[model samples]
Target chain A: MTIKRKILAAILALALPLASPVLASEQAVTFVQNNVSKVLQVLSDPALGDVQKGKLFSEVITQVTDVDVIARFVLGQYAATASTPEFERFARVFRGYALGVYQSELSRFGNEVLEVQSVQERKPGDSVVLTRISGGALSKKSRDVKWRVITIKGTPRVVDIEISGVWLSQHQRAEITGIITKNGGQISAATKMLCSQSKTCTVTG
Target chain B: MALAGCVHPPWRAKSDPLEPMNRAVFAFNTVADKTVLKPIAKTYQTITPKPARKGVRNFLDNLQSPVVFVNDVLQGKPKRAAKTLARFAINTTVGVGGILDVAKAAGIEKHYEDLGQTLAHHGVPSGPYLVLPLFGPSNVRDLAGLGTELAVSPLSFTRFKGKQTFGRVRLALNTMDRRVETLQEMKTIRKNTLDEYVSIRSYYQQLRKDAIADGVVDMDELPDFDLIE
Candidate 1:
């Protein structure tokens, strides 16, 4: 049998529910596949207005993605310095920004094929799902995207995405930190800037 | 302060006596990249289709085979020279004058060898790390190697109806092609790295070390500062 078939057989043998604490590679992959499929479907829907689509995208994305964890990570060293309210505010704005980014990226997924190749454990509680994205209109080469899934308690949440060997979280961190540093260590201004530009601004509020 | 009292980072070589001058040149290269090369590369990328760009890259690689073969022989690697000759022959004819990489498809692996690498293989030490204006990182030995390679390149002597202009255009296009390929990655690096110059320096040194070892060195063991971590 092929690897995918073998994996499916193993999952069938286990007969565990999808939300079980025992997150095998198959289960983690299923989480991503299910959400990404929904994203693609939502993106391709012709009837939905931009605002409705944005809200739907944010709702679906927040289910599988760890917004708070990613928000703290993007804050980097600034996270330690932020007040409780400042941290909450930054996280709120960052979540909206991230949702907007996801929505924009979804619009470019026309005719592209995303295949889950394998899932391998990188550390104790973290697994990376390797996916190949090919045949997109903007891409000439097939891109290898790695989704870092972190299981907290029993829920597997996507913490980061790596494309072309560079982590999206790292890029976001650098940009956000650069903005905060430029504004003389004011996270509030950066939060405002991000919120003003995000498509999720109204939805987030 | 006396030179002996000056503290240098572990990555900097004692032979790098002209570091201030080199740093100035490095700064100049950055400005040139930002103002001139980047804009041209962007336009080139926008105008050319992806497949056409690959073809251009292939053609350029095929043109450089003569230099590779000569350097292989100079390094006393008969087997490598033979391989280079075979690759060049197969790629030029079957690969349609090197517009496609059929040799690679046929399991003929590709490798790069230059006069600088040949010199390193022959026990020549890399003297002070030098940053050449527009050309970027180099050392004394590599600079000499580059000069020799330029003189020996067959493309330098090839004459067309507009020979001089043709060579210049070819060189410009080749540089632009290289620039375009790394544009996105370089932007990411620039955005992420705390100090671009120092990061590039460490990364380049590690790269050269690996190249000198013929890619046999353990990548994880490569010299790492904050650039990678």
Candidate 2:
């Protein structure tokens, strides 16, 4: 090959890979923005009752969030210790808790004006979509929240939320770890704590 | 998010029997919030610097830590109780009377346990839901539990001269601060809901349930989202 052709090939290789991440991250932003607004509409729908809303919100959560990943993350060190059944139970319970938390806090930002500010590739596998939520005439405060998004098998999902520099996954990890530590490092004890706390968790063993 | 093969029963209880009375009180409270509380909160937000307002909130939270700690113990959550106590001590001293929230910096986030939750933890069912005018959502059990907590809270009965006035001011400020924080959210709900009363009641019920569950929800009911796309 000629020198110019080799140089062109090298530049093309570098530029193509570099440009692809930007495009992927941009798509991630679109995915988050579109899904969040749709969820807000569901929350704001007057035709639906609370139960229906809860059901719809849960669906949205499942689609948008990497619940299984978050579940394992919440277990933290307990994941290594938990039996397969115990781990499965914990995951189920964690998913429910997270969905409820998200549903309850939906209205806080749902009504406000949301703007996607920027999207940055956080690491090799994930992108961060930054957004600003501005309160209307009645509210004076504005908040910035970031969604850590990752693509799994061509589907993008939110794995964490960073509100004011605090990650939701990290917060859950702290809480779960605290429980396990308090219960003397027994995952079952933590499961019992979760089962007692949450009505959704029928698995008590 | 699958409704495939699940057997979790409905978690909601038919707690509100006095819908008519609750609706009336809710209306009254709405009007009061619009005319009185909202304006005051708006003005307070406008006048107060962000840092000072945050400091005020921190201070109030520090004060309430004792209540949270007591409730944590009552709920038999030793970890939460210890964390609450540690947060209180660190915030009180290092946070400079809780004006800075140093404990948060130290990784001790706030643990918000209340007597109502304590009662729920002990299997005391949430009897008929009640909406008190100006105070917002509550159930019979929570209302009773809140009454007891208030009675026991040290901040309720100040010992210094002009104690009654001091207590009243504190209560008013706390209410106003909360109103300010939730002003936008309240406005959104009102704008979005066709029947504000029903929506508020429903939301409150669900919120209380989630709290009782310590934020856990029933995942079985969630539908498939793939069809939407």
The candidate scoring highest on TM-score is 1
Cα error of candidate 2 at position A121, Å: 29
- What residue pairs are clashing in model 2? none
lDDT of 1 at B31: 97
DockQ of each: 0.04, 0.03
Query: Could you give candidate 2's per-residue lDDT for residues B1-229 as a string of tens digits?
Result: 5773343322222355666578789889988988998999999999999899899899988888999999888888899899999999998998899898988887776758788888888999888889987899898998998899888778656577888887788789899999889887687555433246655665666556556666432333221222211
Instruction: Compose the digit string of candidate 1's lDDT tens values, residues A49-115.
Output: 8879878878888887888888887776677788888888888878877776556545656556778
Runs in model 1 lying further than 4 Å from the true structure: A1-24, A46-49, A135-141, A182-184, A199-205, B1-54, B61-89, B103-167, B178-229
The local distance difference test score of each candidate is: 0.73, 0.73
Question: What would the TM-score be for candidate 1 when compared with the true structure?
Answer: 0.59
TM-score per model (chain B): 0.86, 0.86
TM-score of chain B of 2: 0.86
**Model 2: interface root-mean-square deviation in Å:** 16.6
